[model samples]
Target: MNDTATPLLDVRDLCVRYETSGASSWRRHLTTVLRDVTFRIGAGETYGLVGESGSGKSTTGRAILRLADIGGGAITFDGQDVATMGRRTPLAYRRDVQAVYQDPGASLNPRHHVGRAVTDALRRHGLGSAAERRARAEEVFVQVGLTADHLTRYPSEMSGGQLQRVAIARALVLNPRLIVCDEAVSALDLSTQSQIINLLMDVQEQTGVSYLFITHDLGVVRHVSHRVGVLRAGELVEQGETKALFEAPLHEYTRSLIAASPASHPQGRDERRAARQARRRAGVGAA
Candidate 1:
């Protein structure tokens, strides 16, 4: 676990709304999709938001990136609140907070070369000279396990795993402080998923960057996350240190998820969970 006391990123009471059809107008009947979701990530910490489809994990990530409108609450990154960021400040925020989407093919522009796509953010952030950006793009390709020859290829030319690697390479190019990986590995095969997980851990070891890993895979979370947050129906139901939460959960929904997980056992699991939570809370009380 990270020993750092101060959080690198802090999200508080964040809410997002999407406007569907309404009686007043097209924009008037706004639906609150995500409600008061909150969590924290420290520097070099990997936090996973685990939930099924339509659980609001993507909405939370998008809200922080300002891709979704913030209906309420604060997203603090590097000690600055993003919800309150001015136009001039958002440019810098983009340099620090990058995103990787689930579908690599859809995320990449088919018209652009792999190298061009990877260097787009570098150019936008004005990281270096043209030659430097080109060189770095090629370097990041290797860093993400892609070959140097891929510089000229398009997203359509690569396999799903390769496409995802390119997406990761592109996110890494900017050296962002935090990366919101929105179901980033869900489309890959299991073997490829392991490779990506190893790559992420390796990158974090080399650089102090943290990750906001959003996924439905509980097994993946068990392996990669230092902390985990469970979201259901647009609300954060439970969150704690990964080991602590997995070993001892306080919420019924969390227990239900554990039971349904492939890794769970059928023998006295509910009783075990109850005992664990009781012991944990007792220990906390003693402390």
Candidate 2:
């Protein structure tokens, strides 16, 4: 519900499909991973996509990052169509839109020190000289709560949270306008998750970078996202401002999702469950 005239990233009527084959002699299938999905993220805004596993949340993120097979629709960034970008435009687009995935250890090379992994993007894009790149890496490392000394360590030397911070620093070094955070905080413990989420908010405030946060945790979405979209069976079932959607979700699926969240107090779980059942019954009776 951003009133901004031009959003930083806009996705409309998006569809994605994967070609699969069964064990049969001649059987092939086209499975739709995402269908008619639409949403927008403005400058410095966080748009959260939440759903259960296989709900297409990660597929949507991949499509936005141009890593998936786009079956239909348009993904526009800064008023430019991503699908149609030619030659050097895609590289520029990648520079503007970076990604941070769930497994930081897998993302970072074990052989190289974290410093090289962080400044690799800068070197690829020819951003600055070695000294400048090192300075930028140190600054970003500090920004994400890491110290200068930690940069010399390899992925094996750091904790899970620290490695994730290094991943975020890598994305930040590019100074991108949009970041596709695919389950970026799901792997951490509760305390570390809170720290990372707060760090992301602080980074946004400092850099005005937008986020497309994809995760299955509704509670995390509520804490980090400005707007929330609920995906069910590859389709967007609900989308609205986070507070409003959590306070009173219009979709039955969304209501059930909220009721299922672990954040619900144990004492009130049954009451919330009953209320959700009643709502489902009322809708069915009315229909």
Candidate of highest TM-score: 2
Model 2 alpha-carbon drift over 4 Å, by segment: 23-25, 86-89, 264-287
lDDT of 2 by residue, 156-231 (tens): 9999999999999999999999999999989999889878887887798789999999998887888778899999
Instruction: For residue 189, give model 1's deviation from the true position in Å.
Output: 0.8
The lDDT of each candidate is: 0.83, 0.87
Backbone clashes (count) for model 1: 0
Q: Native-vs-model 1 lDDT?
A: 0.83
Q: Which candidate is the best by lDDT?
A: 2
Candidate 1 per-residue C-alpha lDDT over 64-156 given as tens digits, one digit per residue, 9 for 90 to 100: 777888889888887888888644456778878888898978867889887888777788877899999989998889988888899899887
The collision pairs in model 2 are none
